[model samples]
Target: MIELKSAGEISAMREAGRVVAGVHAAVRAQAAVGVSLRELDQVARTVIHEGGAGSSFLGYHPSFGATPYPGVICTSVNGVMLHGLPTPYRLRDGDLLSVDCAVHVDGWHADGTVSFVVGAARAEDLDLIRVADATLAAGIAAAVPGARMGDVGHAMSAVGRGAGYGMQNDFGGHGIGREMHESPFVPNEGRKGRGLWLRPGLVIAIEPSLIAGGGDDYHMASDGWSVCTGDGSRSAHVEHTVAITQDGPVILTVP
Candidate 1:
């Protein structure tokens, strides 16, 4: 069921959102060439610990997961779209990195993601990242009251298709609350004027992940966690936790 948060609940959620945003900011600044994904996870752990927040990803074992997720952050690089488990692999030049983090404060949860190039930025890499970012923003813009969930998906599709990029609907955003991955799945491509109606206090994660190639096919890595493009092309992902309100969409996980 889609639970509409109360005013008090929204306040608590904002606290969680603040921590999530701070963690993303810290990770973005600390990301650089030669840094290990494990090291980046440590940075996120420190931020969550210092802020007295709990990790929403750590120890999380979803139905699709093989084991309990052991990291506080997800470090998806290049072809990996999402759920790239942290490892000892170090970053290299021209690597497009996607960092996803979530935090819980006083029982409320917030999630966010950021994708950027580590050292040297390729023109195509920059374009992919930029388009993903803009696509996420457009998705958020569709979260206003009275808007259907399909409208959000439509906006996301327009951004990706307009850029000549294929949509990866295998994984997308979802409603989030006391637990992560709540009701009302949000896809990256869909028709408008369909699905659930948006209302005040409905919070959802609007994540737009895309590959620069021309197909939506993807493959799973041997690690049983990371997912990569089937064509081996680079991928980018951007996300923000947004809330529908009487005033419109409010970005809760802003950095």
Candidate 2:
């Protein structure tokens, strides 16, 4: 069921959003060449702990995953698409790091993601990241009240397809509130005016996952969580949990 948040509940979720956003900001500052994904996870864990909030991601066991997740944050580097578990693998020059983070504060939750190049930015990688960011912005723009859910995906598709990039629909966005994943699945491509009707209080994570190649074909890693690109091409992802309101879409996961 699609549950709407009360005003007080929305306030609580904003707190969670800020906490997750802080984690992203801290991790962004610490990410650099030679830094291991494990080290970055530690950084996020420290922030989550000091903030007095529990991790919504830790021990999260979805039916598709082989086992419960073990990290506080996702560290998808380079060819890895998403759900990349933190590991001893160190970031190298020109590596594109995609970090997905979530946090729960006072029983509410917020989620967000960011992608960036560590040391030297390759032209192609930079382009893909830029497109993903723009795609996310477009998706957010299409989240106004009364807009069809498919409009959001259609907007995102315009950006990715315009850049000749491949869009990933297998792992798309979803309604987020008490849990990390919820109802009203939001795909990356769809016909406008074709999906659920947008209404006030409906909060959903609008994530744009794009690949550099022609297809978003990917496979899970041995870790049972890491999903990587099948063609070994670099990818980028950007997300923000947004809420439909009488005025417009309100982005919760912002610092």
Encode model 2's per-residue lDDT on 185-228: one tens digit a residue: 98888799989999888999999889898686998888889888
TM-score of each: 0.98, 0.98
- Candidate RMSDs in Å, in order, are 0.9, 0.9
Off by over 4 Å in 1: none
Residue 220 in candidate 2, Cα distance off native in Å: 1.2
Backbone clashes, candidate 1: 0
Off by over 4 Å in 2: none
- Which ten residues in a row are the worst by lDDT in model 1? 6-15
RMSD of 1: 0.9
Q: Give per-residue CA lDDT, model 1, range 1-255, as digits (tens).
A: 889988788778888888888888888898899999999999999999998899999999987777899999999998888899999999999899999999999888999998989988999999888888889888988888998999999999998889998778869899998987898798888789999899999999989888889689998888878888888898888888888889998888864
- Model 1 whole-model lDDT (C-alpha atoms): 0.89
Report the alpha-carbon TM-score of model 2 versus the true structure: 0.98
Candidate-wise lDDT, in order: 0.89, 0.90
